[model samples]
Target: MSVIGVVASATGGVEQLREGLVRPLLDREHQVAITVTPTAAAWIAPAERWELERITGLPVRSQPRRPGEARPHPPIDLFVAAPASANTVAKLALGIGDNQALSVLSEGLGSTPMVVFPKVNAAHARHPAWAGHLDTLREAGVVLVEWELLEPRTEAKRELPWDRVLAAVDGLADQFFQGRLRDRGAGVADGGDG
Candidate 1:
């Protein structure tokens, strides 16, 4: 079984969690696990996990982990942090492994291909702190699927293209499961030819 790990922080969209991510992963019947930040638990309701359990028919594990410890797994095929919040994005980019999500990333990053779906505000995305982090993550072999494109005209997050996001996930799965991502000479777009 190809193990896939999904990480999310407190400040992003739940639709990213429900529809954009879990639905696509489960539709393929891949073994999936999720780790959420404490801030995210505070932001979402209990019923949300129940709904995920029903929709994905997979256990939604959200217990916070001790700082610096990665989740135990036999072998992970891919690790993706969708709707990655600015706070978490900066943390992961800097190699700070203080939580399960970050620790999982730190440990599992090179063992298999990983991706980060950044979903910060346009202002935050351009902030030097975050931009530098994005660069660092890219150099560290993390595939960045997308980020906020421009400043928000209103104080609300807009809907992202779920189909494209799923396509990216599917692309990553193909690369890792097919052993092409570790080839070191292939371009990122090699997997985008869908």
Candidate 2:
């Protein structure tokens, strides 16, 4: 079974995003695991979890961990961090898996596809380190979905386009499956028993 792991920061519309994506996956009978970061849990309530359970029929699990706890590897076929915070982005890039979210990424088995959806303001996203980190991930074959086209004014509210975001999610899933299949082939060749 294909496992799609969705991880999000405690930002606006995170639950809505998760709900939206999970619905389609459920309709198609795909396995979806919704993992919330520590920051995400602070804002999401029990009511929200109940709502998600109703909508997706999938139990929502939070990866509550501090800076040093080891993360559990759930055989993640594809890992996605949406509305990704700048702090989390930096931590992932620098190999600083201090929290559950970052820690899970580190513990992900080799050849597991990873996607990062950055939701920071345009200015923050343009930082040298951020840009470099993104480039590094790309070179390492990690898919990055950045909202650079949106221009946030000084007093403007940042809003992500759901349509575009969903489309990006679909694209990431495609890439992830391709990578996983290639890796499976490699594994088989290393020790073929067939």
Candidate 3:
């Protein structure tokens, strides 16, 4: 199974993450590790941290990993930030790793396929700085997972669909598998399990 590192930020749509994103990954037999921003953790009513841990079977990280720690962050084939707030997105664009979620994103910037499902409100999205941040991420090879940025509160939050993200990851996983198979084939053909 492919492993996906999911970063959930503090946003209005954050509460829907488990059902919208994590459950689909589980159904697809993909392993998921979630890192919730400290602000998001607090925003979640009744605190779904324990529930998420149970569902994912991995500790839900909410703090940055200490340097030289014996244990390290779980390895993953892909990275995603869902319900990413304007603040989180901006920090990531600026390469700020001050928080756990952003730190993971910073590490995955180039090596891993990264997608961010932003949930910016009209007011925030219209800010002049928002465009610069997005541009920075684009230059860094990060894909901004987007849905219709319509008027907010008029309807349910229309962030990038979780299914869309899953489909994208599936394609990435296929590429990864094919690459590995090619490497293995090359080794075997060389008269060694290289």
Candidate 4:
């Protein structure tokens, strides 16, 4: 099973993260670890955080570990940033690791498979740098869930397009494992005994 590291930022639909992303991932038998932006940590209730911990069986991190502290979550095979705010996307594109969430995403940029769903609005997209930020991430091989796929936000709450995000994750993880398996097979074919 792949270890999926979910990073949530302070966005409108972040409250639904457990239901929309985490729980479904667990149901699919993937181990899940969560890290939230500082603002997001505050946005989620303490009781909710406890529930997340109980279900995932891992601590939900929002802050960096101290000098001697061992890492809390296991090494991640894939990363998902669902409900990623515009600010988070900008920081990630600029390689800014101001907080734990951004730090993880920043480090995983090109090496680890990542799927980011930027929960943004029209105004945010109109920003001149927005296109450039997306280009940078795409160049790094990050699978971006297009904004058009998300339902338009209204006075009444709307759910984020978690299905699309998860689909991207599933596809990327499959490709990653297949590539690894192919490499191993190639090694064996070349008479490298393991």
Candidate 5:
């Protein structure tokens, strides 16, 4: 099964991450490894954190490992950053890895396929640099789920479109694997051992 790295920031829908995204991915037979921003780590309730660990069978990392320590998670095939806060999105665009979550994402920026859902309000979108940040990420091959697609939320029901995000991930993973297979086939056709 493919291992998916889930990077989350402190956003409105973060509290539902375990139920909305992780569990669903697990049910789909994907191994999930999660890393969260420092603030998000603090914001998540203890019981929820424990449940995340229990369900994923992996540690929920928020800080960098000490020097010379073995990496805890397996190599990730893809990344999903749901409920990505405006602050985190901007920092990612700038290649700033001030925290563990950003560090993992920064290293995977170009090489790995990623799906990002910007959980921002109109005020945040109105920032002068917001568009530029999104453009930069897009140019780097990040698939963005535009905030407009997740509209019409009632004040009491602030939920995210986790299913849509998962669909994007599935689509991208298919494309990535198909491209690799085609490349391998081409090499084999040319009599080169693949």
Candidate 6:
């Protein structure tokens, strides 16, 4: 089973954990692990964590592991950051991994297939640095699933669009695996690359 890492930031997307990610991963018989930002962990309800743990059977972590500590989660093949915050996007693109969630995301950049849903507000979306960061991420093969434009709303979830985020990541991961298999087959048939 493929292992997927779900990183949640302190935004409305955190609210979509179970339905948008956990259940879908479980339904696919994939193993799921979660890492949250410190503020994001505080945003989660205890009942939510209990339900997620029940499904994943993996402890959710928000802090970096101490030196020599056993790594609790498996190395992920696919990574998704939903409700990704502006802070998260900038740090990821700039190679700043000050938190557990960001570190996981940064480490997965090229090796692991990644999908990021930035929960940016209209004001932040207009910032000059915003487009550049997104550009850098897209250049690195990080797919971005953003909300369809509409009249601005104050409610956060309206901007988050977890459903779209989930679908985008699934489609991207499928494409990634298909390409990998095709490449491997071609290499074998051609008697390797020399």
Q: What are the TM-scores, per candidate, against the unseen true structure?
A: 0.78, 0.75, 0.86, 0.94, 0.92, 0.88
- Per-residue C-alpha lDDT of model 5 across residues 1-194, encoded as one tens digit per residue: 88999999998899999988999999989999999999999999999999999999999999999999999999999999998999999999999999999999999999999999998877778789999999999999999987463333544555698988989999998998789899999999999998
What are the C-alpha RMSDs, in order, of all predicted structures?
6.7, 4.2, 2.4, 1.9, 2.3, 2.7
Clashing residue pair totals per candidate (backbone < 3 A): 0, 0, 0, 0, 0, 0
Writing each residue's lDDT as its tens digit, candidate 2 over 40-114 gives 877778887777756655656665646786544346777777767777777777778776677777666235677
Model 4 spans > 4 angstroms off: 149-155
Q: Which residue pairs collide, candidate 2?
A: none
Query: After TM-score superposition, what is the CA distance of residue 141 in candidate 2 from its true location, in Å?
Result: 1.2
Scored against the true structure, residue 52 in model 3 reaches a CA lDDT of 82
After superposition, the stretches of candidate 2 with alpha carbons farther than 4 Å from their true spots are 53-59, 64-73, 149-159, 175-194
Instruction: Provide the lDDT at 122 for model 6.
Output: 79
Q: In candidate 6, which residue pairs get closer than 3 Å at backbone N, Cα or C atoms, i.e. clash? A: none
Q: Return the number of clashes found in candidate 1.
A: 0
Models sorted by TM-score, best on top: 4, 5, 6, 3, 1, 2
lDDT of each: 0.72, 0.68, 0.81, 0.93, 0.92, 0.85
Local accuracy of candidate 6 as per-residue lDDT tens digits, 109-170: 97789999887777778889999999999999998988744335664344356667768777
Q: Which candidate is the best by lDDT?
A: 4
> What lDDT does candidate 5 reach at residue 56?
95
Error of 1 at 132 (Å): 1.9
Rank order by lDDT, top first? 4, 5, 6, 3, 1, 2
Best by TM-score: 4
